[model samples]
Target chain A: MSLELIKDILLATVPLLVIFPSLFAFTTWMERKALARIQNRIGPNKIGIPCTRIGLFGLGQPAADGIKMIFKEDIVPRGADKLFHLLAPILALIPAMLILCFLPLEFPWGKFMSGQVQAFLLDSAVIFFFAISGLATLAIFMAGWASRNKYSLLGGMRAVAQMVSYEIPLVLSAVVVVMMAGSLNAKEIADVQTGFNWFVLTPWGLAAFIVFFVAALAETNRSPFDLPEAESEIIAGYFTEYSGFKFALFFLGEYIAMFAISGLAVTLFLGAGDGPFLAVAPWLSVVWFIAKIFGLIAVMIWLRGTLPRLRVDQLMAFAWKFLLPLSIFNILLAGMSHHVTVAYPGTTAQVVTWTVSLVGMYVMAKGLDKISRSTAKPREYLYAE
Target chain B: MSILGGGIFKGMAVTLRNFVGSYFSKERFITTNEYSWRPESELPQSIGDYPKEEGEQLSDTTTVNHYSRNFPMLLHDTGEPMDTIRCVACQICERECPPQCIYIEKSTEKKENADGKPQFYPAKFDIDVSVCMSCQICVEVCPFDAIVMNSQFELSTPDRFGGLLVRRDDLLKSNDYYHKIHPQEAATRDERMAADKAAKEAKKKAAAEKAKAAAEAKAAAAEAANESKEDTE
Candidate 1:
């Protein structure tokens, strides 16, 4: 039992040490370089050791930045709540890191290794992922209330509001995926998505996916939905009081959150790590898994590079009006499909489910548009009474 | 258009074009953002390939026009090992300068020119670029065409007194470097100088010819007087 516990600990620890730093660094480099390219500028091309031309085109930059952050002075405010201000960064960082524990990095190995590769397995990992990610909002709140700055406090409030607003749609969309698979196990969901038969290949799954992706963007505090940490408006948001290693911790948390969220998205919609001929090679699935994660991350960066932040009122409107309703309807469609597939069985069942769900979703979307349009137009006032 | 997230898709397409357009056809980004710290030698002269297509070779600094005048530099003749600071310590630029950023100390030891008149050059020339507004007043006020502004703009430095102070040696640029940056202006200046030189030479030649004619006319008149006297006797 002790040996088993040690082996399990090693499984989690090995990926944590090797993968997290390299992953975070790569994401940082990729985001900057891609953002630069999108905006038509060269970003971070010069940071490296003194002599060589082998700078890897700003790959060394994150390391340079990380080192710089470590050496920076850690300052604490005089009027700050000493305990929580000290704990804020730790609170913010731990949840993002812990989310990685449930994310399955599945690879196929026939006889030599375990068939299903995961750091740890839980039957209710989908529930665990949503539950754990929801806690990151608390961390943001903790940082804000503790910092003693009004801006930091406001940022903490925004984080709470946005997270609460988006979490409904986020969880609702994932519930649809969970309903489709009929199991909460991450690996089992991936197994169903084998051979290009991903849930996203269907209309209902596609809508859920779009909703989930947008909510995930909001949840992770990415741009267009990045009001919680909008640097221009909020002056570093909850992290305003943080500096040096404390600031670096917040950054680390964000990067890890991005990885975890995108990793979960890959598993849920794009067939976890399932690709064609992945069964034959087995170990090749992990490569496919990583590629999908990076691909999703690239999309996130593209969105960040492209879109401007929404107004606070506009942001709230989008969550309540569009995402909330759409996700609920998606749950309805997913449940119906599951019911029909079990009751009737075979291709006719699939065809019936497809037609009903697609048509139902289309009708609901039109109804939503009309409702929004009507509500958007306010009556004019004749007098300034 | 009422399309779902229409603005987002449109903005995304625009960025996608910029991202992809940067690779295939770079003529779109006409003016690259010139970072102050990036070395002039390391700047991208033309839009480089997107990182995926080709390995981004560090590009040359952009070809700036004659008017992009960031800072002023002294033009030096390449013939005599960078001989002559074009500024003669006239101080016309010094007085006319709005910022009064230029400092000129006249050389006490003056050397006589071909005309046997003493010519003065600056002993110590400095332009506090930190203070200079880059208005090109010094270039305008220079009488000898010595302070023509050159387009080497990157003047960012760490030190205030040491780094921001433009020295005489660092300020002097070769005539070729000036022409490369400001070809039309350099050419026009050279033509004007050549025309002035030609007119001066023409005036000198005419004076010399008139002097010879006067001396010959005096000799002829003297001979006539002698002949007439002899005939009368």
Candidate 2:
């Protein structure tokens, strides 16, 4: 690429770098508040209230927590491999930050120019987004391996296993979208999705959306699938040896990952940055995009609150046994359907694709319902012996 | 394929329903003043309430709003007022208390009972209510059933120690008071007591029969020895 292109790329990155972190922080607050509601408990309602009420139900809880984390004592384990310990959090954080570089916040600012590309959007973004997001697993594995704790090692191993297992389904799910959209660029995907024909309404798009959503949850290491940081089992997993601002970096990375995944979901399924009367008021799409993201985050919080976590084996089985095959099938079907649709416009092949997808979805859903029913055991009350 | 999207929509529809349902299910929503409004007497005693009773139902109405009210409400079981708890100066509660809030002084009563035996009563039974975890361990382990968890959980105080320190007079309750809070369990325990008494009576009858048999055998042996001696003479 020319120097001007390089300059354009750099300029484009600055806004995303700033905006992405802020989005992560926003999600952190939203997750807490939403989960609190789901769990039937009041979240932080204390800190920023007018007067310093002793137990004024801390409204500024997140702010207080953030402040506390900032001033927390940074601890480096005496026995840990010092270099790895130092590198782990940075490794964990960098990839999450970098993934935002390709995430399309909106369609190219106003009619994509030839040389000087806009700041907020990307031209060929989808491939770039997936590739970078896929790299987060590397950062996670490094953090886990570097920690030098047995728990950290196990967590790292699980992180790697989980990431690797889910990555297939995650990518395959996206591949279906790519097949239909016929481009690796996210902006084009978004552009197509604008108006009533949102991808979530399409056959491959719906499947891709579902798989992608589940995969996003797995990738972010959020609840139910958070075997890595399972407080009960591994005790904060990869970050067990980390503390203070270093730990904060890992913390921020997680939230940013959530933000990125939410954004990606918006782009792929919900019609990224597309709003009512977007032809008239294009800026309204940003609100729609954020709303979609927040909605996903709310679901994440709901899952966290309502569901008990999955076992490591259960999580792996979910990825490999269920998600992987389905995603692969979805990808194959999408490609075939797309090819056939292109070869013969309005043919029986398209109808076949539609019918097969419907039947397949019904079967999968029924199977899941059965699995869930059989697997779910009621919690027994313990009368103290 | 449209039907496939139907499943996704169905899922979203359920989520939407949940989103609406959540608004109605504000019962789970956490509030700072969740339990503040309910009176101490109204507050439901959980498992670990000091001075335990069987089958106590703690009220949900006693949110934090009731807790913030600036008054000490005397705890009651139903309508009858229970100003004190049945904690004997046994110090068992004090020693076994996890938080070490209870303090007791065992003293012998100089005044004799109808049997002319000294009565044991606690001179000072003080529970530093501020320190009490309300874990109810004292109620669980109390041998005499002297101490039980009370339903009065509202113990918020401005002075951590002053008003919160429950004196012996503050914690005492009658057996009738316990029964009122948990009548069914009390009745069941009463049934157990009757069964135990009946069992003791049956054991006594069996023991008497064995004693009489042993006495008759001894007498027969003595008679035989006497008769043999007479024949020898």
Candidate 3:
């Protein structure tokens, strides 16, 4: 049992430690590059190989940045809570790794490698992923509280408010997938999404995907939803007092969390590791999974580069007044379809139900928008004579 | 504006357009130029490529002519064996400088210049660019037309305090440099100087002629007075 535990830990940690850091390094570079392109600027291209003189189009940037971060002076505030201040980043980072244990790196169609490809295939992995992710909220709050700074405290408060508010909708959308699959197992969820139709193609699943994605943005503190650490407003939020490796840790945690959440989104909606010829080459599933995650990340970067941040009130309203009600409706719609699809799997009843819910969603959204529009921020305009 | 998710889709479309257009389109050329790094030999090569011929302005974007304020400089003769500074140690500029950044010391041991006159060259000249307001007041007050503001403002240095204190050698630029930067001004100054020299020469010639004619009249009057004395005897 001890040997088994050791083996499991090694399998889990190898990816988490090795793949994630490299992935994070490159993802950061990608985000910077993509954002630069959107804004019409060169991102990073100076650090060239010494002898060969080939810069490789700024591939050395991440390595240079990593080294610079490592060499930077570590600063801890004089009045900080020494324990939690030190512990916060660690707490924040561990959840992403913990999540990697349940997350399937490879989901071979009808070909099992005794579940060795995945670190763990727990039945309750979906709920567990959500639960583990919740720890990050505490970590952020701790970082803020420990710093004894007003900005940090406010950032912590925002983190708590934003995370708790959006988490409800996030889970509700996840529950839609759960109800449809009739199983809490992640593998089962992904399996159900196979064949010609991915869940995102379905009407109800489309609504749920939108909700899930927006909520995921909030959950992971991606921009447009990144109110907790809004640099202009809160001065780097909870990590204001952190420096050097500690700050780097926070950054790493953020990127890894993005990966973890996007992975889950893929599994639930995009059909994880399910692609053409997956029945023949099961390993190709990993490639499909990675490709989907990267696609989602690219979208995230695009949104960040394009959209302005939401006002605090607007952000709260978006989570509570907008996303919450929409997701609740989505859950009901998903449950009804799940019931129909179970009795008569692949029947027109499912299609009818999907169509009904979609129409209902549209009408309800329009009604809610009408009400909100009346009460929302007024748009004053000038009259031209 | 109040439509359901329409604004977001529009914004996304704009971003997508920028992403694609930045690469392939001339109209949407990325304003970002990676200009930080270059080989040491690149500057002269670039300068060579630029049209240095008269009457044609440079069309290069990298050309540094956007409101380039040449720093105040002292014009100097390049090949002369003697100390060649146009400034005659005049203190008008020293007293008139608003910021009082310019410092000058007249040479106690004056040197004989080309005109065989005792010339008071500045023994030491320095300008604390840190304190300088760059108002061109010193340039205005210079009686000898010695000081001129150069069209080069790239005077940034690593040292925050003392390094910006420009020395005598650093402040000196060739008259050619001044002409290059201010062609019109230099031409006008040259014309005025030439006219003044011509005026002085004409005055000298007139005075010499007048002296010669007066001497001839005096000799004739003395000759007449002597002849009249002889007749009386």
Writing each residue's lDDT as its tens digit, candidate 1 over B82-112 gives 2445666788887877788888888887754
Over A295-339, each residue of candidate 2 has an lDDT whose tens digit, in order, gives 888888766765568877778877877787778877777777777
Every model's TM-score: 0.67, 0.65, 0.68
**Clashes (N, CA, C under 3 Å) per candidate:** 2, 38, 3
Using DockQ as the measure, what is the rank order of every candidate, best first?
3, 1, 2
Q: Supply the global lDDT for candidate 1.
A: 0.79
Q: How far in Å is the alpha carbon of A295 misplaced in model 2?
A: 2.1
Model 1, residue B106: distance off in Å is: 39
Q: Each candidate's DockQ score against the native complex?
A: 0.35, 0.15, 0.40
Error of 1 at B122 (Å): 36
How far off is residue B132 in model 2, in Å? 13
Between prediction 1 and prediction 3, the one with superior lDDT is 3
Candidate 3 or 2, higher DockQ: 3
Question: Which candidate has the highest lDDT of all?
Answer: 3
Q: Model 2, A330: alpha-carbon shift in Å?
A: 1.9
